[model samples]
Target: MLVLGIDTSCDDTSVSVYDAKENRVLSNIVSSQYSFHREFGGVVPEIAARKHAENIDLVFEEALEVAGVGVKDLNLISVTNRPGLLPALLVGLTFGKGLAYSLSVPFKAVHHIEAHIFSPFIGSEPEYPFIALVVSGGHTLIVLVEGFGSYSLLGKTLDDAVGEAYDKVAKLLGLGYPGGPVIDRLYREYDGKYLELPKPKVKGFNYSFSGIKTAVRRLVEKGYPAEQVAASFQETAVSYLIGKLKKALKETGVRRVAVSGGVSANSLLRERLKELDVDLYLPPLEYTSDNGAMVAYVGYRRFLIEGEDTLEVGALARCPIS
Candidate 1:
């Protein structure tokens, strides 16, 4: 089956064509709006939505062209319709619906986080009854995955997501937008000693990054070196994430774990995960961010199990995976 996936969950306009029969992604095209949101130091919802509207069509065409497929050849159209910026989600959802209607194919509404959960298993089947740690710009949560279409929300952020905390800290340290990569780079390049940041004491598997972010701000206000502050913050944040994952692994007794979302691409986090004595799955860098490949792959899997969604389904700004 040929499935076309569209995802405009945040600042990226991504489109992909997945060949289910071959279990491979034919094409995955992403157009990032980093340049537009850079000066603002973060994503502006209105600007992201506008850019998605302007870019989605061209991205869709390019995806199909690269995949060597035609609209008529696509058997299903999958789109991210929930748990994202409302305006941005609507742009992709509306366009996907139109294409599905024109081509007379099934329309599938995919959950953004759920797509991230299975991103690493795109070309291969995922082992069931594992743990999923999803960390990203807009979300931070852990889940117990029993099987396809079966998920138990383990815990999530009570405040800012980890990636958001990174961005906020970077802005405080005079770094540019899309903070993760730059901060990661600084953490490696700077030999400056890091400040002692407090670890948030959130109960259970839940996370709280707002406290860490505020602590970093105070250190910056105290005139600490920017590189030291960046290094300190990154170390603390990534350690916190790993600490929680360890807790979850021990408590749940799940031996297999998969980490997804943009933050999963962190070098420190990846290095730490390798130290654990359990099976680990991480998506290639391309699938780490908000992209259509994972969305399309999950859509195809969900469609096989739950069939298609009604055309009347609407976009949602906040939706739970449970």
Candidate 2:
């Protein structure tokens, strides 16, 4: 089947065409709003929504053109509908619904996070019942995936997510917006051993980045080299994540592990996961962050079993896959 996916959840406008028969993405396009939000040191929801309004059509056209298919040729339409800025979600969902209706084809609303969870499956072998660590700007979660749409929440952050902490700390150090990339770059430039930060002592498989964020704030006030501070913070955050992932593996004894989400693009996280003795599936750098290809893949999978969503399906601010 051929599916077109749309994602305007947050600051990125992404669209893709997936050909399930070939198990490949025909075209995946993502227009980042990072440059627009950089001055504000974070995403401005109003600005994000407006940008999506401007770029959605252009992105859709580009995706379809690159995929070498017209809208009439598509068998299904999928769009992210929940757990995002309401205005942003509305833009994509409305466009998707309109397109599906005009084409007289089945369309489905996909959960943004669920799309992240299944992202690694695009063009890769199917590995079911694996542990997934999905760390991103808005969320940090570890889930046990048994199959498509079947997820068990293993652990999640108690307060600020890992990516949120990264942005806040970058602001404290006068780093630009979308701090995860900046900090990851700095981690390679400086030696982090000089500035030691305590890892949070949270119990079980859950995560807690708030304490680490607070500690970074204090360290910034005390005066430390920005590069060292950035490096240290990145290391500590990755360590915390790796600790929980290890615990999850031991507890559940799942030999397969996959990491997804925006933060999953971190260089350190990938390098660290490589050392672990298990079957690892890490989406390519492009798919690690938000993208439409993953959404399309999940949509096609869901449509096979559940069929299309009713036009009444509304966007959700926050929803869990479980």
* Highest TM-score against the true fold, candidate: 1
Judged by lDDT against the true structure, how good is candidate 1? Answer: 0.93
Tens-digit lDDT track of model 2 for 1-322? 8999999999999999999888899999999999999999988989999999999999999999999998899989999998999999999999999999999999999999999988877886567889989998899999999987789998899899899999999999999999999899999888547577877777677888888888898998889889988998988899889988999999998999988998999999999999999999888999988899999998998898998998888999899768
Each model's TM-score, in the order given?
Answer: 0.98, 0.98
lDDT of 1 at 8: 98
lDDT (Cα, tens digit) per residue for candidate 1, span 97-166: 9999998999999999999999989999998899999999988998999988889998899999999998
| Residue 158, model 2, lDDT | 87
Q: What local lDDT does model 1 show for residue 173?
A: 89
Total residue pair clashes for candidate 1: 0
Tell me how far the alpha carbon of residue 192 in candidate 2 is from the true structure, in angstroms, after superposition: 5.6
lDDT of 1 at 239: 90
Which pairs clash (backbone N, Cα, C closer than 3 Å) in model 2?
A: none
Position 286, candidate 2: lDDT: 93
Question: What is residue 150's positional error in candidate 1, in angstroms?
Answer: 1.6
Give the Cα error of residue 179 in candidate 1, in Å.
Answer: 0.5
